[model samples]
Target: MNAKRKNKILTWIATISFGVISLIALFPIISLVISSLRPSSELMRQGISFSINFSQLSLDNYLYIFNQAPEYWAWYGNSLVISAITIVLSLFFSSMVGYALAVYDFKGKNFFFLLVLLILMVPFEILMLPLYQLMINTQLIDTYFAVVLPMVVAPVAVFFFRQYALGLPIQLMDAARIDGSTEYGIFFKIMLPLMGPSLAAMAILQGLGSWNNFLWPLLVLRSNDMFTLPIGLATLLTPYGNNYDVLIAGSVLTIIPIIILFVFFQRYFIAGLTTGGVKG
Candidate 1:
C-alpha cells in the first residue's frame, strides 16, 4: 500500500479501538443510570442485570429524593460549599508555594520541597489518627474547616503547579519588577493568567477530591446537616433497612456537578496536563 493509504487505515483502526474503549469505560456509569431508574424492590429482587424492565421503571426514586429528602439537599449544599472553598484555597496556597519554589531562592526551600514529596509518599490512612487527634485538640471537628484545612496545601497540586511554572519565562517577572510591580502584583497580574491551563486542571482535581472526600469528613462532621454527599448517602444504609431508592438516585444526581465542572474546564485540561507532564 502507498504511505497515505497505510496511514489512513491506521487512523481508522485507532478510532475504532478508542471508541470501543470509551464504551467499555462508560459501562459502569450507564449501569448506574439504569439502576437508578429501576424500582428499589426490583433492584433488591433482581440485583444489577442487563435485563431492562422498562415497564416497571419510573421516576419515583427521583421524586422521593427531590420532594422528601431535606437532608439530601443539606448534604448536597455542604459538599458544594466545602468543595468550592477547598478548590479556591487549594489553588491559591498551592500555586503560591509552587510558584515561589519554581522562581525564588530562599533558605529551606529544598528542604520544604523534600518534605512535601515525603508527605506525598505517605498514605493518608497512616496520618488519619494523628490528624483526627489534632483536629480534636483544635476543636475543629464537626466543622467545615476540618474538612477544608487538611487538603488546602495539596502536595500533588503544589508539585504539578511547580512543574508547569518552571517553564514560564522569568524575564516577564523581572520586567514587571522594573516597572514598579510588587512580587504579588507580578504573580497576580502576569504569571497567574499564564498558568490558566494548570490552574483549571488542578481546580477540577481538587474539586473532585473535596467533593467525594468521605473519610475525613466522616471522622470530623458529626451532625447530619454538616455531612457531605458521600457521608449522607452512607447514612441511608443501616442495620435495619437500606434506602436503596434514594441512594441510587442521589448517586446519579451527584454526577451532574462533576460533569458540569469537566465541561467548563475541559478546554484547558489537556493543554495543562501536556505542559505539566513535559515541563514538570
Candidate 2:
C-alpha cells in the first residue's frame, strides 16, 4: 500500500479502538442515569439493563430530591462550599510553595520538599489518626475548617506545580525584580498568568478531590447538615429502608459539577499536561 494510505488505515483502526473503549467506559454511567429515571422497585427488581423500558421511566426521583429532601440540598451546598474553598486555597498555597521550590534558594527548602515526598509515600489512612487528634486539639472538629485545612497544602499539587514551574523562564522573574516588583507582586501579577495551564489542571483535580471527599469530612462533620454529597448519599441506605431513587438520582446529579469543571478547563488540560510532561 502507499504510505499515506497505510497511515490512514492505521488511523482508522485506532479511532475505532478508542471509540469502542469510550463506550465501554461510558456504559456504567449511562446505566446509572437510565436507572435513576426508573422507579426504585423497578430498579431493584430489574437492576441496570441494556433493554430500555421507556414506559417505566419518570423524573419522580429527581422531583423527590428537589422537593422532599431538604437535607440533600444542604449536603450539596456543603460540598460546593467546601470544594470551592479547598480548590482555591490549595491552588494558592501549593503554587506558592511549588514556585519557591522551583525558583528560590532558602534554608530547609530541600527538607520541606523531602517531607512532602515522604508524606506522599505514607497513605492518608496512616495520617488520619494523628490529623484527627490534631483537629481535636485545635477544636476544629465538626467545622468546615476541619475539612478545608488539611487539604490546602496538597503534596501532589505542589510537586506538579513545581515541575510545571521549572519549565517557566526565570528571566521573567529577574526582569520583574529589576523593575522593583515585590516578590508577591511578581508572583501574583507575572508568574501566575504564565502558570495558567498548571493551575487549571490542579484546580480540576483539587476540586474533584474535595467534592468527592467522604472520609475526612465524615470524621470531622458530626451533623447531617454539614455532610458532603458522598456521605449524604451514603446515608440514604439504612437497615430499615434504602432510598435508591434519590440516591441514584443524586449520584447522577453529582456528575454535573465535574463535567462543568472539565468543560471549562479542558482547553488547558492537554496543554498543561503536555508542558508538565516535557518540562518535568
Tens digits of per-residue lDDT for model 2, 12-86:
999999999999998998888888999887777667877778998899999999999898899999999999999
Candidate 1 C-alpha lDDT tens digits along 70-135: 999999999999999999999999999999999999999999889878877788988999999999
For each candidate, give its TM-score against the true structure: 0.87, 0.87
| Model 2 residue 72 distance off true place after TM-score fit, in angstroms | 0.7
**Candidate 2 lDDT trough over 10 residues, lowest sum:** 271-280
Candidate 2: deviation at residue 7, Å? 8.7
| Candidate that would win on lDDT | 1
C-alpha local distance difference test of each model = 0.88, 0.85
Score candidate 1 by TM-score against the native.
0.87
Root-mean-square deviation of every model:
3.0, 3.0
